[model samples]
Target: MQRLVLLMLFLFCFGSLHAQQTEPKKYLVYLSDKNNTPYTIQQPAQFLSEKAIARRQRQQISVTTRDLPVNPAYVQTIKGTGVEVWYTSRWFNAVVVRGTAEQLAQVNALSFVKNSRSLNRISSPSATNGTLAVKNSSGTSSEALNTMLAPGDYGLAYHQANMLGATELHDAGFHGEGMTIAVLDAGFPGVNTIPAFAHLYQNNQVIGTFDFVTRTENVYGANAHGTSVLSTMAAYLPGKMIGTAYKANYLLLRTEDAPTEHNIEEVNWLIAAEYADSAGADVINSSLGYTVFDAPSVSYSYEQMDGNTTIVARAADFAAATGILVVTSAGNDGNKTWKYISSPADADSVLTVGAVDSLGVVASFSSRGPTADGRIKPDVVALGANAYVLNSAGNLVKSNGTSFSGPIMAGFATTLWQANLSKTNYEIIQLIHRLGSKASAPDNTLGYGIPNYSRIVTGLPTLGAEEGVALVNPVTGNDLIILLADNWRIQLTELQIIDATGKLILKKMLQPDQERQTIDLQALALQKGVYLCRFISGNQIATIRFVKL
Candidate 1:
C-alpha cells in the first residue's frame, strides 16, 4: 500500500531564475523547539533568495499561511540565501525549508529551525475536464442473482475473477476486512437499511459518514448511485453473490450538491477528501467526474485537461502518491463530440475507470481517452449498464453510468491490495495491465481489460516456515476438516469452500496460527463431491482440491 497523502490547491506556480554567482549550496537544518511542546515562529527571511521573490510574486504566491508562519520582515534575512519554505503543518510540528547549497548551510546555522530538504514535488500529468454525475435510479430490483448467477454472469465479476487477477486476491484472504474506503459522491439514499448493505451494518463496517452537501452526518440522499457503488464492495452474501471485497469498511462522503453548480462544491470535495485522509482511509473511491462548468468561460479546454491545470486533478494525483487508491469514473461522454475523459480522470496517477456492457463491449456512454499527454486511460472497466442500487425509499433500483463501474473496480482494487499487503501501487497496476494485456492487448477503451484475481492466488510468493499441502482425513460420517498453513505468513485468516464449478458451499474464519481446523461440511448445505478450498493468509495464497466424503 502507498502512503496516503492529499494536497490541496493554491494555484500558484513559483518560478526562480538561477543566478550565475557562486553556485549556492542546500542544507537541511533541524530546528528544535528546545521544549517538547508545539511551537511557531516567523520564517526567516534570510532563506529566500531575491530571485525567488520575483517568481513568487509573478506566480501570485502569498506568504500568509495558517500552516506556516510567514512574516515578510523575517523573510528578508533569508533573501538571496537561495532558501525556500515549502509546507508547514502545526500538527507535524515541522516546516519544510529549501535553499541553494550555500544558503541551506546558512539557514541550518540559525537556531530554532527544525528540518530542511531538497523539496521536490512528484511529477504527474494534468487532470481531465468533466463532471461525474450520477443519474436517478429506476425503482426496480434484479431478482437475487447470487443464487442463480455465476461470477461469470456479470462481465465485471468475471473480469476480476478469471481475467484480471482478482480471484487470487480473494483466495489470499484480502477481502478488504479491515481497510477503510471513503466514497465521495452524491447521496447514498437508503444504504443503511438496504438488504445489500445489511452485512456492513451488522458487521460494524459502516464506521463513519457525513454529508458535505447538507452539512449533516446522514447521507441517505435521493440519489442511488452511491448505494450501488457501495454494494459493489461491501455487500455480503454467503453462497450467493459476494462483493469483490466482502468485508471492507466504508466512509460515505456526500460532496455533490445537486441542483446547484458552484466552485464551492469543488472546495467542498477538497475538504471532504482531507477529512477522509485524516480518518485513515485506505482508499478513496470517487465516481464523480468534472469538466464543463456552469459558467462557459470557466469551462476547461482540451489543452487545460492536462492533469496539472485542474485543482481537483492535482489533489487526486497527490492522493494517489500518498498511497490511497484514488479511483474515479472516466465519465459518460463517449457519444458526445468531446468524446474525452473528464477532470481528475485525466489525473495521471488516478485509476480512471470506464464501463463495459454485459458482452464485454465498451458502453457507449463510457468516456474515451488518450489523455492530453498521450497516456492511455480508463485504466479498467466493469458492469455499468442497468446496474443495481438502493433508492432513498429503501428499495432496490437500477441505474447506468461509468459511475457504477468505478466502484466495482474500486472494490476489486481494495481486495487486491488486501491480498498483497507488500505490493506497491505501481506493482498492483502493472499486474493488472500484465494480466489484461497478456490475455489480450491494451487499448484506450480498456487499458487493462479486467483484473484476474486467480493468477495472483496461484502466483504470489510463498510465506511462513512450513511448506507443502496438508492432508486432512475424515474422522466420521459426513465429516470435513481443513488443513491450514500460514501460506501468506500473516496467517490463514479465512477459508471458503466452493464447488469446482464456483458455487460457494461454506465460509469460515480460521486463526492464523492454528494449523488444523474442522469445519462442519454437512452443516453448510453441501452435497458429497469434490470442492475447492480457498485459503487466505496475507499477500500469499493458494487453493486446494478436496473430496467431501
Candidate 2:
C-alpha cells in the first residue's frame, strides 16, 4: 500500500521508488562498486588530462581509485539490457539511462546495481522557446564607491567588480589570463553570436561547449538565463561593459532543463563537473541549485541541505577535491517562506556566493545560512541586485538573482587566482574570508561581509578594516570620516580615545546613524603623540593607534 501511494504521488529524487504508470523516461542507476575496473590509480594519465594531473600535483592531491573511470564492462552490461545509457559518473559510481519502466526494471535487478531512481523531464514552451528572456531598462541602482583607473575599462560593470575589491586585482594585470573557468548552467543562446563576445571568438578564449541536458556538443538556444550569467564574466565590451574575467578561457556546459525541476539536473551537474575535470578546468561556476521539485514528496527539506545529504552537494565537494574551486549561488529564497540555501550551496567545499546590492547591503532575496551542520554558508556576497548582464539578443541590461552574483565572484576569483598561481584553491578561499570587512565577526546574514580590495594587495591591517567599519585613513586636522559597513549592523555604539599614558582623553557616544565622526587635533590642542582609538559595540571592540601630527 505504501509503495502504491508513493507511485501514485510520483516521488522523484528523494528515493529509489519506481513510478507506477508514469513514464519517468530517465533514471540514475548507482553501481555497487568500481570492482573490476580496467583503469588504475598508477596511470591517471589515461583518464585525467595532463593539466588536471598537474593541478593535483601542485596541490599535493594524489590520484586514487576514486579518480578512475567508471567500469565500462558494467556499463556495457547495462546497455546490453536495451537501456540507452547516456552518461556515466565516476564520482557517484552511477549511470544516467533512458528506457521504459520495464526495461529499466531489468537493469535495476542486476547484481552490480545498488539502486535506481527515476529522473523527471518536463518541457515548457516559455523556457525552451526563448520566451523567458528577462529584461530591465538601463538604469543605475548602486551605493558602492569604486576606484576606477580609467573610464574606458569595465564601463558599467565597474561597480560590481570594484565592490568586491576585484578592480585592484584587475589593475594589477590579472585579467584572468591563463585560467579556465567552466560555467555549468542552462542554455547559452547568444554566446556564439553576441557582439559582446566577439573578442572571445577572435581570441579563442572559449575552449568548448556541451549540452548535458540534450547530450550534444551544441550548448545554445534553450534559455537566456545562462547567456546573461555568462555576460557577467565572459563578455568583453570595453568602453561599454567588460566582464570580470574576460581574458580567461571558458567552457559552456548546459546542465539545467529549465522548464522542469527534478533531481536529474544534479546528476547532470555531476556529469558536467567530471567533463570539466577531464578538460583541465581550474574553476567551476554553478548558478543552478536544487531546492523544490514538481512533486513535493521529492522536494528537499532544510535538513537535507546538510552538505552531505544531496547528491549535487556531494558532487560539488568531490569536484572541489579534484583541486578545482567550485563556486555556486546560494539560492534566492530569503524573501520566500522556505527561506534558506538550496543544495550544492550547502556543500562544505564549495564557495557558496550570496547576493548583495552595489552598496554592500545583503539582498532580501538572497538565501541565508548556517548550514544544517551549523557552518556559515554564502562564504561571500557580490553585486546581484539590478546587476548588469547582456541579454540573449546581445543587449546589455539589468537582472536580479544570486545567479548573477555567483558568476561575478567566479570571474574575480579567476583573476585573483591567476595573479597568485601558487596558492591552493582552499587557501584562496581562506584569504578572502580574512579580508572581508566583517572578518572579526562573521554572521549568517553576510559571511565575513564585503571584501576590501586594497587590503588584499597591500596585506596591511588598516584601521577598522576587519571590523566592518570603513574609515578614511591619513586623517588630518581638517576632518575625519567613517562609513559603516552594511546599514550599521556592526553598529558603532561608542568611541574612546586614550592618550600615551593610557589616560582617557575623550569619550563619545555614537549612534547607528552617526555615519561619520570628526576629531581635530588642532581644535583640541592635543599633543603630537600616538593615541589609541577604540571602536566599541555591544558585541565586540576594535582598537587602532594613530600618531597625531
Candidate 3:
C-alpha cells in the first residue's frame, strides 16, 4: 500500500515559511560517543528487557557499547545549552531536541555534539509526508479460538491466509503462540475504541503504546492509518475476519508525523525500532518508507537507497542484528516517477515486501527495485490488492497498497518463526528467500515472489497446487498465464475452464509443455463471473473455484 508514500502527502501543506521560521526548530543532535554510560553492556537488563537479552543470547549476539543506553552525562550536557531534549537513541548515540537558534548554536558548539540535523519541515508542499496506513495484526491467546473455530470461521481471511500458506501454519497450531510484533506507523486513532481491537484490549495483548511524534503515551489519536494496519494482523472477529498473527502481542508506536515529510520522521522510526528491539519484539512491521523531502531539507538521492546510507535503513539492519525480524513495505511509487523501493526497505536485513493481486500479477503501484546498489529489493511479494482488513467501524474492507501487503507478510513471518523458534532472525529471513518461488529466477518486480510456506516444514512444494487458486484467480488482464507445479507437467495434461452452468468455456490438451502457459481470455470474450478450473493429470484431478474481482 501507499503507507508512507501517497501523493496526497506530497501535496500536504504543513506550514508556510513564516510559521516554520518563527517556530522553535527541532534538531537531531548526534552525540560524539556513548562513553562512561551508567548502564553496562554486561547488565543489559537496566535498559533491555529479559526477553530482549534472551533473544540476543539465543542468537549468539554479544552485547556491546551500542547496546548501552545513550550516555546520560552527554545528554545532560547537551541540555545544559538550553535545548529541550525530547528523546535519546542508544543505537545512533543521538538525541532529538527543540530550541531557539541561540540554543542550537550553543548546543552545536559543545564538543560532545558531533552534529545537529534539522528536524523541521521545509516550506514546499510537494515533499514526502508519511507512509499511508493499512492493516495486518496482533492480539492474545488463540487457544480459545483454535478449539472453537473452524476454517470457515475465517471467511475472507481464509483466502489471504492460504495465499501466504499461513493457514497451514495456523492449522499446525502455531498461531503466534509466543511472539511479539511491533507496529511502527503514523498513529493508531481508533484502536483503543474500535471493536476490531476490543478483543486485544480484553486479552491484554496490546502491551504498550507510544507516539514518538508527540513523545507521548497516547497513540490513539491523530490518524487512523495505524488502525487499519493493526487490524490486518490483530482483528479476530470470527466469521468476519481474522489476522495472520492475531495471537501475538503488540506494541503500537507512532513514529510518523503524517502531515510532513522531514528527516526527523526517519529519526522517529529509528527510535521506535530501537524501542522494539529493547522491548523484546520478535518482529517489527513498519509500513513506513521515505524518499523525497521538502526544500531547505535535502531529499534523498537514488544512490542513497543503497541501504547503508539512510538513518532508518541503518537502524533496520541493526534491529535485525538484535534479533528482531523487520518487515516493511517496498513503497508505492511503481506507477510514478520515483519508482523504487524506499529506505529501510532497501536495508539488507529486513524482508522488503511488494504488492500483487490474487492473480499474482504485480500491482502496478507496488514499488520495484534492484536496490540502488543492485541488491534485489522487495525480498518477496504478498497479496496486497484488495487485501481484507478491518476499518475503525469493524467492517471487513478491502485495502490496497504495499501498506497492507507488508503486514500480511510480517504477521505470516511471525507465525512461521513461532513454529521454528530455534531459527535466528537471519536464518528465518534466509528460509523465506530459499523457499520463495524460484530463487534462481528472482526478479525485482516481485523479488523472489510469494513465499512457499509448505516447503518450510515439508521440504517440498505443495503438490496440491489447487490451493493456489486464491493467488491465481479473479483474472483482470486480457490473457491468463498459469505457472504449473513440476508434477502438474509430468504427464499429458488436460485443462478446462467451465462456466457456472457447467458448460465448457474452453478446453486444452497439453503434451507436458513447460510450466507456464498462456490462455488468451480476450479471444474467448468471456463474461465476468465465478468459474471453475479443472485440471487432469494422469488419473488425478482437481477442481478449483475462483472469482472475477
Candidate 4:
C-alpha cells in the first residue's frame, strides 16, 4: 500500500512538471531589419511583463571604475533587469526581457530571436604558405635540411602563407626566443608528445601550463582550440608551416568546459588572468567571448555588451592598462543574428582582432563592431581562413576562425616589442595603425587593416632626436637658452656644471620652467676648455658640451 502511494504521487508530480514546462515561456526576438522598427514589441504591455517593465524604467546603468565615478541614478538604473539595456564602449546597447513569443507576434512578427547557446570551442589553423624550417619529427638527434623552400611563386597556399604574421616576425627577428607568452584557452591535447613541438619540450620553452577549469596543471584533454592557438606561436615548421615566435615560451589556461553550461567558466578566466599577470609574463592572448549564459534568466541581452557589463571585461581592461600587451579574438558570428561582438573583445583598450582572407578582404564570419560608445573595433587583422594547423597527433590540419589570427598577430607583436623594449604601448599601437591602413577611414570590420612589417621597420619615424645641453657663449657670464624642442621633453631634474679636467665646478638642481628655459651662467666660477652640463630626468640623463672663458 505504501509503495503504490509513492508511485502515484511521483506520476502526478511528473505530469504536472511536464505541463508547466510545455506552457509558453517568454520568447526573445531579434529584428532582422534593425533599420525599421528596431523593437518588435512597440506596445508597452505586450513588450514586457508588468514586473520587468517597472524594473526597466526604475533602474540605472553605469560602468565600474574606481577613478571615474558614475551617476547614482545610472547605477540605480543598472541594478535591475533593465540594467542589461545599458550601452558599452563598443557601441552595443543591450535590452532586457521584452516579451513572450505570443506577445511578440501580436506586437511584430518580423524579428529574429532564439535561446542563447552554451559555450563552444572555436579556432583557426596554422599558417601553410611555403616551406618552413622543417624539424625532424623522429625525436632523435638534430637533423638539418639545406636550403629551405619558400612558397611557390604562384598558388593560393603560397599567397596565404605570405599573408601570415609569422613572415613579419621572422624578418624582424622576434621568433619568440627569450620571451614568454601565455595563452589562456580551453584545452591542449597531446602537446607534450607532438614531434613538431618536441623542440619546446627539449629546450625548456614550455615553461609551465595550468588548467584553471579543474584547478590542475594538466591541460591536455578533449579540446583542440588551445592546440591550434599555441602552435601558431611555437610550432616548428621543418618544411611545411612556420610559427611567428617559434622560440618564445608559453603558458596554457583551460577555462572553457565544452560539456557543461555554467558561468563559472568566466570566473575561471579571471583567476587565470590574475595568474598570468603575477607570473611576470609580457603578453596574454585570449580567444574567448561571453554574451550568453546557461540559465535563461541569466542570459545577456544586446545592451549588456557594454565595456563594464561583465567581470571578464573589467579584468581585460585592467590587464591592458597594467602594461601587459593583450590580444583577443573579435568573435565568429558575422552572418548570425547576434552579429555584433562578444564580451572582453568589447572591452576598452584591448587589441581586438578580426579575420581576413588571403586577398586582404574581411572574412565573412569575422565579427563586426562599433562598440556601444561608437568606437571602432578590431584594431587589426590576420590570416584566419582555412589556414593550416598542427593537430594533437603532430599532423597538419586545416581550420578557420578569428581565434587563429589573434595569436599569429600576437607573436609578431611580441617579437617587435622584444626588439624595441623602450616603446610605450600606445606608441606601438599607433605605429601599427599608421603603417597598416590604406591611408583612409578605419572601419569596424578591419580596425586599422593588417600591419605591414617591412614598411613599419623602414617607415617608423623616431619620436624625437637626441639633443644635449650646450653653452651658447664661450665668454664669461653669457646667458644660455637650453633648447629642448628637438627632444621629447626636457624639464631637467638636476644639473651639474663641470670643468675640462672632469672636476665639478658647481653642482645644483637646474629647474626648467618649460620645454625651453634660459638660465644665467655668471654665478658659477668656471674655467675654459670643454666643460660639461649634465641634466637629469626620470630614467633619462642628458649632457651638453660647454666652454667658459
| Maximum-TM-score candidate | 3
Error of 2 at 271 (Å): 0.3
lDDT of 2 at 479: 55
Which 10-residue window in model 2 sums to the lowest lDDT?
130-139
Better-scoring candidate (TM-score), 3 or 4? 3
- Can you write out model 3's per-residue Cα lDDT over 266-361, one digit (the tens) per residue? 988988888888878889998999998866678898899999999899999989989889999999999999999998899988999999998789
Candidate 1 vs candidate 4: the TM-score winner is 4
The residue-by-residue lDDT of candidate 4 on 295-411, one tens digit each, is: 542766667777777767877876665456778888888779988778788888677888888778888898888777677877888888876677777677778888988887777
User: TM-scores across all candidates?
Assistant: 0.59, 0.76, 0.77, 0.60
Error of 3 at 94 (Å): 0.8
For residue 321, give model 3's deviation from the true position in Å: 1.2
Query: If ranked by lDDT, best first, what sequence of candidates would result?
Result: 3, 2, 1, 4
Report, for every candidate in turn, its global Cα lDDT versus the true structure: 0.59, 0.78, 0.78, 0.58
